[model samples]
Target: MDAHFARVLADEQDDAPTPGASAAPPASSSRAAPTAALSQQQLDALVARADAQELDQLDARSLRTLVQALERRVRSNALARAKHADAPERFLESELALHSELARWRHVAAAPAALLPELAALNAAPLLLGLFAHDNADIRLDVLALLAELTDAEDDLADADALAARRVWVRALLEHRLLPLVVTSLEQLDSAPGVEDQDEEAAGVYHALQILENVADLEPPACAQLCATTVVLRQLLRQVAAARRFSANKLYASEVLSILLQSGAAPRAHFMAGTVATGTATAPRDDSDSSKRRKQAGAGDLLDRLLQAIAPYRKRNPASEDEEELVENLVNALCSVLLLPAAQMHFRRLEGLELALRCLKDRAQYVFSGALRMLDLALMGDARNCARLVEVGGLKALFAVFMGKKKAKKPTATATATTTRRAKSEAKAKEEELTMSILSSLCALLSPAAAHDVFDRFHAKFVENDMEKLDRVVDVFVKYLGRVEQRDLAGDDDSDDDDDNDEKDENEDARYLRRLDAGLFTLQRATHVLAHLCASSRKLRAYVLVKLHEHRIDMDVLAQILKEQLAMLRGGDSDSDGDGDGDKDVTDTDGERAKMQAQRTLLVHLLSTLQAPTSDAASSAVEPKQEEAKHET
Candidate 1:
C-alpha cells in the first residue's frame, strides 16, 4: 500500500473508537491498517492536533472525532514505543502526553476493570517508570493517588485489589532498576522547594509512608531490604526526626517510623527513639494534634518493642534533658500498655512491678501518673502479685502523692490556679485510696518501715495546710488501721486467757469492742474536721450543714462535737473562726468566705470518696459516725 493510503486508513482506524464505548466498525468491513510511514511534517501536524493547544479553535463535532482518533493513536503508539529499542525523543514526549491524557480521559471513558492493569503493564517499562517520579507535583500526586486507590480496593486474592496492587508496586520498587528513582522521589518531596506546593509534597510523602507501613504484611523481605540500606533509611529517619518539630510534617514522619518499628526493622529504631525524644520534650514543639495522631496510630506498640529491645538503657543515666525526655516518653508509652487489661494481667503474672517501680522514680508527670495507675490496677486486680508491688515502694510513692512535697521540677510555670488545685486534689484522692487499699492488702505482709512510712505519710497530710482534707485522709487510714489493730488485739486477748473459755471469749469480745471504739475516734477526728469546717465559713457551714443533714456523723461524736460547739457559741466568745483569739488572720477572713472555701474543699473531698465506692465495710461504718455527729449537733 502507498504511504498516503496507509496513513488515511490509520486515521480512519483511530477515528473508530469513542470515549466510554467499545470501538465500532467503520463502513468498510476490514480493520483499517497502520500508516506505512509518515513524513516529519505530517507527524508534526498530527502531534500538534493531539496536543489540543487551543480547544476553542476546533468545531465540537471535529473535537469529538479528534479525541476518538487520538485515543486509538495513543494506545497504538504506546505499544510500539514500548517495544522500540531506541524510541525517538519526540515520540517519547508524545507517549508521555498521551499517557497523561489517557489518565484524564479515564473518567470520561467507560474504563473497563482491565484498563489500569493494561496501562500498568505498559507503564512499568524502564522508560515509562521514570515519569512516576517526575518533577510536576500534580502529576506525581495523581499517579501515586491512582496507584494507592487501585491497590487499596478489595477483590479476590488473585484479583486487582489493594493487596494485589501493593504486591505489584512493591515488586517493582524492590526488583526493578528504579530503586534509586524511588528513593530520589522520596527525598525530593521531603525537601521539596516552594511553599505553594508543600501540601503536594507532604501528600507524596504520606503516600510513600502508607505503602511502607504495610510493607511487612505485603513484602517483609522488601521492608527488611529497605531498612538494611543505611543510606536510604538514614535520610528517611532524618526527615522523620525533623518532622517531629513541625506540626504539619510530624504525622507523615511518625507514620513512617511506626511502620519501621512494627515491621521489626531494628535499624530504624533510632528514628523511633528520635520521635519518642521529641514527644517527651519539656517544651516539645506545639504539634499536639500531629503528635497525638502519631501516638494513636501505632506508637504504643512501637514503644513497647523499643523498650523491650533496649531495656539496658533503663538504668543508664540520660545524656541530656532531651534524652531524658525521650526516656520519659518511652516509659509513658509502656506504662500505658501496662495499664491495658491484657498487659496488666500479663505483667502482673510476670512480676512487672519491678519495672513499674522504676517508672515511678522517673519524676516525669505523665510517667508518674501512668505508673501509679498501673500499680493500683495490679494491687486491686492481682492479689497474688500484690505483695511484689508492695515490696517495691509502690505504696510509698502513692502515699507520697498525698504527702510529699510536690515535685520541685514542675513541668510548666504558667499553670492556672484552678488547674493546679484540681491536679493536686486528684493526686491526693488517688494517694489516699491507694494507701488504704495497699495497707489492707498487706495487713501482715507489710514490713514495719513500710507500715510506719504509711502512717507518717498519713500524719504529714493531717498536719499540712488543709486540716479538713487531712481529717478524711486520716479517716481512711484509721478504717484500715483499726481493722489491723483489732485483729492483733484479739489475738493477744486469746493468748492471755488459756483455759478460761467463757471468760476468755468475753474478754476478747470486750477488747474487740475497745478497738472498735478507737476506730470510731479516728472517724471522730475526721468528723471533727467538719466542725472546724463549719466554724471557718458560713458557706462551708451551710454545705457541711447540708452534708451533716444528708449523712449525719455518728450520733455520739456528733452530740459531743455539737455540745462543744454549742457551749462555745453560747459563751459568745470571739473564737468562731477556730484559728483562736477571734483575731482573724487576713488569710483566714470572712465567715461566708471561709465557709465557701471550706465547703468547696470539704465537698471536693467528700464527693470523691463517695464516688470511689471503697470497701463495703468502710461505707457501712460511716453511717454510725454520721448518726453520732447528728445527735451531738
Candidate 2:
C-alpha cells in the first residue's frame, strides 16, 4: 500500500492461472484471515535468504511476489542514488543493491507468461528506465543490458501467449518515454568513432541500440516515435554520419536506421522533409565540429547528410567486411526512402544520379551492387533522372552491368560454411542488382520523356553498337526463363505423401515461392524490358525477334509469363467479387499472382506480333494459355 513496496498480493488475484495449477486454494486454512502484502524491503530480504532450491521451486503466486519485490528494491535504491548524488558513500550500497535487483528481473523472463504482465502493473518500467540518467555509468549500462535481456524476442517466440508478454513489456518501456532517455545516454556516452579504448562505452552504445531494436520489434510504433517524437533518429543519423572508422555501433546505427525507414512513411517523410531537428530530444550545448554537425543537422538536409555519410566509401576502399556491410545498409535505407516521390526529387537535385553512376562504374563488389540498387530506386518514375542518366553516360554504366553480371569470388573446395554462404549471398545480390538496374533503364527510357527534357533518347542507346544492348537483353531473358523452367521442373518431381496432405500443400506453396525467387522475378523483369523495347522501336523489336529465333526459345514462355502476371494482378482478390485497393505496392505479390500488369499486356501484344511461331513447341505454348486467359478475363 505504501511507496516503499509494490503491492503484488492483490495484483495476482486476477492473473490467468499458471499451467497445471489449481483454480482454487486448499480449504485447510480457509478460515484464517488473508495476509497483507509485505513491504518491498521485507520481501527482498526474505527472498534473498531463502534457499536456492526453495526459490527454484516457487509456484506462480510466489514468482509474482518475487517480481514485485525486485521492482521495489530497484526503485528504492534508484531514489537513494539520486538523493546522494553529491555524497557517493551515502548511496554506494544502494547503487550496488540496485544493480543486483536489476539483474534479478532476468528471473521473470523465465517465468510463466501470467507473471510477466505484473511488471507493467507494478510500474517497474519507469524506475528501470530512469536509471539511464544515473550518475554511475556502469549502473546505466547495466540497465541497458538488463532491458535487452528482458525483452529478448527469442524467449517469447514459443507461441502467441509468450509473444504477447514481450509486447506488454515493450509497450510499457515505450510508455515511459524510454526512447528519449536512450538517445540522451547515447549522447552522453563516449561513443564517437575513432575513440581509443572505448570498450565499455562501445558496449553501452551497442546495448542501447540493441534495446532500441528490441523495443521496436515488440512495439512497432516505437520506430515512428523514435523518428518523429524523440531525437533518437537524429542520434542514429549522427552515429551514421560521424563514422570515420568502422565500429559495431556505427554499423548497428545503420541497421537500425534501415529498420526505421522501412517501418513506415513517418521516417521516410521525416528525412524526406530534409531535417532531423524536429525530434524532441535536443542535445546539450557544445561547439565541437561533431557537435556543430549535430546542431546543423536540425536544419540541414538529412538526405544530404546521409549522402555525405556514405560519400566517403564512394571512392575510398572499405577496410573490412563490417565497413562494406555499413555501406550496404546506408544504401538500402536511402533506397527505401527514395521510394517516395519527394525523396526522388531531392535525390535528383543533389546530382544523386551522377554519383550513383560513378559508384556503379567503380566496379567495387558489394559497393557496386549497392550503387546499382541506389540507381534502380532513384530512377523509378523520374524522367529528369533518366535524362541525367543519359547525359552522364549512366547508360554505359548500367548497360555494362546489364551486359555482364558482377562476379563474386568463388569458394574453394575446402571453403568454410561462412565462406560458402558469403559467396552465395554476393552472387545473389549481383544477380538481383543487375536485373533491377536493367528493368529500371527499360522502364524509364521507354516511358514518355520529361516535358522539360523532351529527348526520348533511351531508344537510341539500344540501337547503338549494332543493337548490342538489345541483344544482351534478349540473352538475359532466355537465361532467366531457363532458370524458371528448371526450378518449376524441380517442383514437379513430387513424391507420394507418406505424411499428411497438408504438409505436401505447404511444401508446394513454399516450392512455388522458391521458384519465384530463383528466377521468376528476374524472368518477369526481363519480359518487361523486352516488351517495352518492342513497343518503343520497331528495329529493337525486330532485333529481339531474331535473337529469340536464334536461341530457339519457346515463344509460349511469353504467353505463360502473361498468364502469371494476370494472376498476380488479380491475386489480392483471389476470392473476391470486389474491387481491390489501388495501391500497387501493397496488393502486388510475388507468386500466385502476376507481378506486373504492363508485362502481361506487353506479352500479349508481343505474342500476337509473333502469331506465326516457327516451331510447334512455341505455337502450342501460346494457344492454350491464350484461350484460358480469355475465359479468366
123 Cα displacement, candidate 2 (Å): 2.8
Leading candidate by lDDT:
2
Model 1 lDDT per residue over 1-633, tens place: 124433543566654333222121112112212332356446646655664544324443433544565456445445544554252321333333544454443232223233333434443423334446443344455455444443332342465463564466446545554345445667767665652245656667766555455444566545545655533445444453422343333444444444543443243333343334433312111235634544543433333333332243434444455544554444443443432334444454333566556655544434455455556555543344554554444545554554553463253477788888877665655555544444433332222244323322322333343344434444554453455456666668566746688877687666656654445333333444444333323434444445444444432344443343334334432435454544322322443344344434533443344333344553232222211211100
Tens-digit lDDT track for model 2 on 496-580?
Answer: 4437888876876777697777777677767767665554444555667778899896556666685676675566345432545
Q: lDDT of each model, Cα atoms only?
A: 0.44, 0.63
In Å, residue 327's CA in model 1 sits off its true spot by 10
Off by over 4 Å in 2: 1-93, 103-114, 132-138, 190-196, 274-299, 405-429, 444-456, 489-514, 553-560, 573-633
Please report how far candidate 1 places residue 414 from its true position, in Å.
4.4
Q: Count the backbone clashes (under 3 Å) in each candidate.
A: 23, 5
Give lDDT: candidate 2, residue 59: 63
Candidate 1 residues lying further than 4 Å off, grouped into runs, are: 1-81, 84-303, 306-342, 345-355, 362-366, 377-380, 383-385, 402-414, 418-633
